[model samples]
Structure formats: C-alpha cells, structure tokens
Target: MSRAEQPSRRTVLAAVAATAVAAPAVAGGAAPAVAAPGGSSASGATGESGSRRRRPAGQVDHRAWASFRDWRSGTAQGTRAVPGRRPGIAIAAPAGTLDYTDPHTGTTAPWEYAVWTSPVHRLAVPATEVIASWNAETPAGTWIQVELRGTYSDGTDTPWYVMGRWAAGDQDIRRTSVDGQGDGRSSVWTDTFAIDDAATGLRLVACRLRLTLHRRPGTGATPVVRRLGAMGSDIPDRFTVPASVPRLARELVVPRYSQEIHKGRYPEYDNGGEAWCSPTSSQMIIEYWGGRLTEEQLAWVDPSYDDPQVCHAARYTFDHEYAGCGNWPFNAAYAATFRGLQSVVTRLGSLTDLERLIAAGIPVITSQSFLEEELTGAGYGTSGHLMTVIGFTADGDVIANDPASPGNEAVRRVYRRREWENIWLRTKRYNASGKVVSGTGGVCYLYFPAHPSLRQRLALAAVGVR
Candidate 1:
C-alpha cells in the first residue's frame, strides 16, 4: 500500500507514573544509606529482631528525586564532579569545493564540502559495524555525502564505500536531481549512518574515512558542517553472559509508542513506520524527558497524520545513503539536540550493566538481530532492528517498547532475560555454509538528562562508558 493511503491508528495513552525502590548494592558494597524526602531512611530494610527501622541522624536520601539532579551539589559520598562522555570520534576535514553550472541558466555556482580522512585506525579485533555521526547547516542548494575505506592486515584496501547523502526534505544525491534543490530551506540537522556486511557486504579491518559536503553556490547561505566522526566495535561470536550480578531496580515505566501501526505512511522518509524503530524509540524517550517538537516544526507533516512527531523524527534521522532511520549514532545525536539532555552510542558488557542504567531512571535504545524463534512473541525477526529497553522484571526479564509490534497496545511486552540477552549481545550468525559471520555487536544509545545524579554517573562509569 502507498504510504499516503495507509490507515492511521488511534493514539493510545501509555504513560505510567514511576515509583522509587531501594538502590541495589553494587559490587557487593552497600550503597550509602540516604533519607527519603520526608527525612526518613528509604533503605527498605527492617531493624534487628524485625522491629521497624529508625532513620539515623546523618542519612541522606538519594531516591527522593524523580528526576536526576547535579550530584556534586550535595554531600553524597563517592561522588566527584565529572563531565559526561560524548560518543564517536571527531574527523578533521580539510577545505574543498564542488562547482556546478546550471544548464538552462548558464550560471555557475560553487559548494564547499569538508574532506575528513582518519589516521590508520587498526581494528586489531575486526568489528562488524562502522558508524559515523555529524551535524550540518545547509541552505536549499547544499547536502553531504560520506564515504569510507579500510586497510586489512594483509595490506589490502577496501573500495570507498558510500555511507550516505544527507539533506533536509526529499532531494537526495542518490537520486538524479538539480543541484541544491533538495527538501526544505536553511536548517541545522544532526545525523548518523552505519555500514555493515548484511546491508552493504563491505567489510574492512583497520580503516580510514572520507566526508564530502555538496552545494551549489549561487545561494547566499553558505553550508557549514559542525563536526563529524566514526566508531566501531567487535562483538562476540557466541551468546554468553556472566552467571549473575546485582539487580538494580524492580521496574521502570517508560512511555510506549509503536512504529508498526504507522507503517507505509511516508515513503519519502524511508517508507515511514516500517523503518522507523530508531526514531520511534527516540520519540518515546524524548517525550519521557518533556521534549516535544513545536507546532512550527510539525508544519511540514501531513495535518491529518496521527503523532506527527514520529514522522518528524524519521525525517530528521533519515540517511540518503543507507536510506533508513536505523543509524545508531544518528539517533543519539538527534536526541542530544534537545535541551537538558545528553546522549551517546556505546556498547554495554552485560544485562547487569543495563540494569544499572534502568536503576538510574534512564531508558536505553539498543540494536539487535534475531530469528523469529529466538525471541518469542516478536511475531517477526529482523537481521537488524532497534528497540527501547525500558525496564526489567523482578526476575530480570526485559520490558521493552518494541516498535515492531502491530499496534501500540502490543508495544510493551516482556522477554525472558537469557533469551533477550542472547539476541541483543550476541552478534554472530552462521551462513549457509555454516561459517560464522560477524553482526552489529552489543551497541546501544543511552539518553539521559544532562545532569545525572551521583548514582547515574557511577552506573555509566561501571560500564566503561566514554
């Protein structure tokens, strides 16, 4: 069915109030006891002989705040002020230009594109995914295309792979179009793109990257690229996790939304809902933190559409090169564009690490692949997909907002801990010849308020987050 003809589903209200629970002890050390807002201890522990416990004079309550606060402000021990880690590496682009002449007008215009090449980055451990992120400001006649090349240990270099061409609105370099006449006017956009064998069949060992910004000069507005960078990781060939670790929290209630219901709604934005898991997951978290697109921002969307913000997200995060919204770092960069929030793309070692983030009131968006049988109740399987890890069950099962669901009501579902772990952390698949191939490994995008509490920082630090 054509996207414009797709049926719109009713918006289901799924906001649930979050409740506080005792902070789990980390690494076998008891977390310092803190008082609840009422000056009472919130340890949830009973006194000796089963008597009701009394608050000690010095106890400070860390669990009272529903939202995270600056940890350095209070007397919380083990807390030191530290800067939040921004994900991805920065690429240095030398100056370059592309000049185009209009066939009809016989007028020539010039566009400047920054060229960035990375130093020899040796992936001693070959990774399955190579990802890039950047922010750009361009007028109607400008766009950006990114390419990559890599050198193997045997001294072979992979051909330059086109990561993507990004611009506002619909004009994409992948298509034959007039110079600089893509979608929308001057606007600032942040995007990300990824390359993997499953999609591109292009793999490399140690690598370098190239970025080009295209523009047609007659337009007065000059194109500007704020920053660009790439990242890669090696995922394990088998699915295995540590025996056990501390359970951080009982439950966290993240707002739920579904992408499947909106499938085929906007083909220009990568066929809308069917390919919008990343943006849909991002929208849920954005609203969770009180961020929303203003009406002016939604003006470009179809007036009759339901939840137009999801469409806005898809458009903002879309990549002309890869042609989808599943880029990990792009979604993170998009989420970070909002005020009072910070996001990064990184890998988590285990479910326990995920538990800590949830315990700190942060929801994580993760990438994974699975067979239909591997993840029960998913109804469908994908070679690549994105979902939000909202919370966990008492027994450590996963509670996620899987946008792949057919309806919003089915978005919030649970999966067995081990089963979910295998699909999420394990990125190896066997080919027809029974040979193992690498997959996008335990990668995730973590979004949280800019000022995390002491506990949140500790959780992030434990996972070796940069």
Candidate 2:
C-alpha cells in the first residue's frame, strides 16, 4: 500500500480552523463529521454555476492536526508522534531513502526518509480548491514534503499530488513547488490543489495528507512538524462580492516597515523591497507576538541597513524557483520559525471573518491583485500584493499596513471596503489590457501564539481557522 521510495521526518503541527470540528486528525475514528453550512453535494456549484446567486454562509472548511493525540491518531511508518508543550510528528527511523536532485542547483544527493499519513478527512464542504500549509523546523540537514490524495464525489481517488518540498534553509534543498503536475482532474497551481474544471460538477469530497520527512543519510537530525493542515472551500466566482456591514471598527496598533525603502537593496531576493510585501507583513505579526531575532541572527545583514530584520525576512522567505518572497506557505512557515508562534494559509469568507479575529486581537495578512484605478486612494497598482489588515476604520473601511509605501510612517492606509473585498475575494478579474485574469480568491495567512486564550480560540474557531 505504498509508492516505491525515491526517498523523502518531523514533530510539527498547526491548529484547528474556525469551523473544523476537532475530530481524529484524519477520518473514520474521531468526532463525527460536521457538514459545512447548507451541505451542498460534492458535484455542484463549486463557485461558477451560480455567479450571482446568493450562496450559503461559511463555505470554507479548515482542518489541522497539532495535538500529540492528533498526531498519534494518524498512520505512521517510521515516524513518531511527540507530545509536549507543543505536539508534533518526527522521524523515528528511516523507512527508506531516495535520491533528490535540487532542480535549482542540479545537484543530486541521497536522503533518509519517513512517512506519516493523516486519516481520511471527509470535508464538511466538498470543495473545488484546497491549500495545504505546514509549520515545521527543518534544521541544517532536514526537510519535509507534503502531498494530498483526494477522493472525488464519484468515488475515484486522485494520484498523490506534491504540495511542496520545503526546508527552513536552502542549502539542504531549495524549497519549491512541483510544476507540470496534474491528472486532468486536478492541478496544483503553485500551493493550491484545484479541480481542473470546477464547473463540470466535480468536487473533492475527502482528502488525506501525507508527510514525508527527509534528512541527510546517517544523520540524527530530523525536522519537527509542529502544525499541518489544509483549507478547502467552494467560493463563488464573482467579480464583486456583496457589501458587508461595518462591524468592530477598531485597528490594532501594529509596527510598520515599508518595503519601498529597501528597493534594489538585494535584487536577488525577489528584486528587493518593492516586492518584499509578503515578508514585511510576516515580520510585523511575528514581532507583534513578541518574537524577535537575536542580534546574532541579524549579524549577516549589512551593518547600514535599517530594520535589518526586514531584510533577513526577505532572504529567509525567498523561494528560489518561484523567485519571490511572496510564496504564501513559505511566509507562514517562516513566521512559525519564531518562538511561540504557529501560522496557516487559509481563505476567509468575508471581512466579518477578519473582524472576528481582530476582535480577539489577531491581525490578518491578505493577498490581492488590482489595477491603480480599481482601488481608489491607493497610488499604485500591482499584479499581486500582500498587506496586513490591522483594523477597520469607524466606517468599516480596511486599515492596512501596506508595505508598498514611501516610508514606514506612511505604511498604514485606509482602503475602500467594496474595492478591497472585490479585489481580494474574486476568483476572476481583468488586467490593465482588459484581459481576463485570476484574483486571490480571499487567500490569507493567519499567525498566532502556540497557546491561545479561550476568547482567541473562540474567535479563531468562529472565523474557521484556529
């Protein structure tokens, strides 16, 4: 019941999502599955069929397994579940070894490996798209690979798809997403698993994640995976989303550092500050939670750089193959590298979701693409960008710590609610040339303390990401 090993351990985990019922980490031996709101059949309206039709509230299903017991519930082969202040899974022994050639470096090396498979997860909401994210520490000699195997509504299983092969450091293996992978039914676009055509009445009904932990042969080193999970949703495809009423209009005071200042500083890391939005947003949240890099950690940066941590973040998060620091999961994983923090990459249904978390004092990082004319008051345009939603204005407008600014003092800006929502939530849009393109579809990254207060847990649960 296994694929032949080429070769690919850890004690890492993520938390429960807003609406994911804490069941056995996988399916079949845990809490009974809870259906998503309205529970539509798997083969219907992923998002395209009823573009204008009002859909049920809360369409996304988020699930993660981070508890020691949760890790023990999964199927393990040469893997061990470690229980402690933070529970996670780690390599027990090498079940096999495989030769991995760094496509970025064209160097081949053999690595010892172990496997841990989550129990089947029956999605309360059958989805057209799924994104998997993990929080782990892959030291100098170790890394991990995450893959998803899905079951369609018709009872067919998908070929296992590689979600990502990653490490905190690039020396071992360049963290990268596999390209040109698909089975004609589903395709992995960057970090996402998307139905090739959701409009065909096809949907992913259930899925399981397989974690492959890798380390240099004969080394005791092992990656510890502290958090791992996926968010699956069938969001409607629309250029515009209905306006949400203003709620909880208070902004959290978050430190801001503009990426613009670092422009051209290190062109190798995604062409420097002009494109360091993702890492900048991540560093803000990491510091907000009291995570700081020791002076020793910042020693490598040039002595003259201001806010050197920003530059450090940019370098650490740069995905060589993607050639950008904007890789969603990579940023989240980078945030988790800080002490006492865990992060996830999931989609939010509405601004209300952001409000709930903000009420509990959690800031959100959102991804969107827009033209200069689309988002009024913003002086620039970007094919894609990352901004931190620290709070809302009294009138419900978004108050974001945008990194694309002239200076840190000007990093925070108020964006029109309607324009912001449409740009971030829509799955389709038109480029400047009037050519149709894809939107971010409400994709966001959530970072919080490893142990949260009850109120924080409730808010995260309500928002469908814990």
Candidate 3:
C-alpha cells in the first residue's frame, strides 16, 4: 500500500523520527512529516558519494518489506527524541519491506515503507545515506558513531563499522554530531557509504542509521552522556522502521521456575482457580540472576497486585487474612507463594551470566528458617508441601523440584520452545499499555547492579545481551 494508504497497525504517532542506511530507523519525534530523498530513492541511482550504482530494484521483496517495517514500528518506543535541532534521520529500503515481530505484544506486524521514507524532522536528500548530521560531546573527548546496517546479496549483514568510523584526536566521527552550529554544542555525524557489488548488481537494498552520543565509561566514575541539542533543517513529511537487522538479542534466555495449574493442588489466593505457581517459580531466577532487563522484563516476573497488566499476582504475600501461603503449606499454590521458599537462578545471554552468578557463590536457597520467618512475619500459611528447582542442564532443560511428586521430586522436563512460550504468554494479563506488573502499587522498575563480575560481562557480550 502507498504510505498514505497504510493502516495503523500496532503503535500510533511513531515513524521516521530516527533512521540509517540499509538497516532501520524511525523518525526522532512526532513531527508533521517524515523525510525522504529529495531525489528518487529508487533502486537504480547514484549514491551520496556520486558513484553510479545499479541495484536490483526488486532486491527487497515487497510483501516481506511490509511485514518487517510493521513489526518494528508497532513496538514500544525505544530511546526517542523530540524534534529540535538535529536533522531527523530516515530509513531507506526497497519500498514496503520490513520483517520483524513485537517482543512485547507477541504480535506479528509489517513496516509502512512510504511512511518511513517521509521525514519528520529535517530532510536529508535521501534518508538512507544520511541520517541526522549534528555535533555532540563526550567525557574522554567528543566523538561520533553513525549507526548504519545493511545486508549483502550473500546474506551477510554489514558490521557497525560499515556505516562510519571513529579515530583519536579527531573526535569520534562515528557519533552523531550535534554542535556543528557553533555557540550551542550539539553532536551529529554525516553517514557516508557506497553500494559496491559488481558481481550480483546488488546495490545496498536497505540501510538504517542512528546518530547516538558515544560516551566512554570511566573507571570508578560515572560515564558522561551528550544530549541532542539542535537541528540544522526543517522537519520532513513522515517516518518509519526499516528492517535491515534481525530482532535477535545478543543473549535471550527464558528461565522457567515452578509450573502449576490454577486448578491443580494449589491454594487459590482469591479463590480464583488461576494458579500462581509458575509466576512464583520464575521469580526465583529474576531475584537470583543478574542482567539488564527492561522494566517490562522485571514486571513479567512479578506482576503488580491491583492492575496486573502483563501478568497477575496470585495474592498479596504478606496479607494473611485472605487465603495466603501461610495456610496451605502442602498445596502447590502454597509452595510457589511462600517468599521464604523463594530461590533464585540466572537466565543470562551467554553461559557467562549464569556462571558469574554461580561464582558469586551467594547462597541461592533461603533456609527453611528464613522461609518460616517470612511466612509468619507476613502472615502466610505453610503447609508441608515444598517446591524445589533441582537445577538446569547445560543445554537448557529444567530440572525441577516438586516435593509432592513420587521418587522424582526432581525430574527433567524437556519442553519445546514454542510450548513453553505459549504457556507463559497465555498467562499474561495486560493493562491498556500492556506493561507488566511487579508489586502492589502498580509501579514498575528494574535493577542492574554496577559491580557485576567480569565473567558476567563477558558472557553478556557473547550472547549480544543488552
């Protein structure tokens, strides 16, 4: 469909605000229009470098393009900015192409190509070759990192360096220059690249660019950040998300804790059949494991009490008057609810996040005494029933601890990735915005300690864990 014909899929008022070369980027703000190339952005054209390039006008399959773009745009906004000074970036790809999924809603959507090409902030002749051109500052010194990504006919994706680079004394050119306009020190960088593939005639099909402030972290000191200050051009017509990169995290691990049906042998918090066993089981890992999870991720573990947006809380752990864990210790619901029985585990990108948590050697289990104290103090009941997490196998299998089961209190349950996700996703209850809950007040937050072990950091890198 033409950009104007594109229907609103998932998200609203978010497109072409930020962008890149062959990857993907949306507008930086809610401007009136998304910017596009002043000249034709068709497949066959001259690049910014003025090199004659002939690419398969059909390089990006049209249907696939729609799918990709729709998915990314519909997702919750990541880091974004209001239109101010920087020339808003734009996404360039074979029209109507983007294939990605919304990690939050579990919905599959496509991109709005024409909308992406339309600029929201300042307009660059062609959105692809140039994102935002501005100046920014850093602590070590001012540097730049122009975000760009692309894929070759051989299916090899371009590295971060392909879009731009940085060097010493010269102020990192890789960063988005925001201060070129003197007096006001903003930082922005120009994106420069040539489509060169003589063999297959495959010009750069898709390119996404991001103008980011590159901050060098300091030892025993907080890293400094540069904000986008000013813009050099007028906002464009529209904006969007071009799918030049796959949506795989550096490291993504789903750690399963305890599993129980609401109707199963568990105490119902509100006498509702829905069981809180699995949610309880997962909490152990969140508390124990260490990583940088978004607020949404944390909420998925322990939903809030009043408005369980993403997930539901079985009941208040400390409130004993109602059906609480303090009463049915032997029941499945009781085992999962007891804060004392809580044990944490790691679900990290590389085995490293896990290994680091293990190396910390902090006792993973809360002692039986600790459990009793929590229950009595919080007014939770305690039946004889107990739940345990035997451990996880190297290949990602759950070795669970079910005290109620015969002989095999701990057994390995091999579940397909699809089935596991299905079960977990189905239990999710949502608010209007679809955020996950964490506590009684409905407030949500995530914690990432600065002093993580080196092993944990290294492991996170391996899995592209952010």
Candidate topping TM-score: 2
lDDT of 2 at 179: 70
Kindly give the stretch of ten consecutive residues in candidate 1 with the minimal lDDT sum: 10-19
Give the C-alpha lDDT of model 1.
0.53
Count: clashes, candidate 3: 116
lDDT of candidate 2 over 215-238, digit per residue (tens): 999999898999898888898778
Model 3 TM-score, all chains together: 0.22
Query: What's the TM-score of each model vs. the native?
Result: 0.62, 0.86, 0.22
Quote the lDDT for 155 in model 3: 49
Clashing pairs in 1: 3-264, 34-60, 35-60, 35-61, 110-217, 141-180, 164-321
Task: Identify the runs in model 2 with alpha carbons over 4 angstroms from their true place.
Answer: 1-58
| Tens digits of per-residue lDDT for model 1, 16-87 | 000011111001111112211121111223323222222321111011111112112222221122223322
Best-to-worst order by lDDT is 2, 1, 3
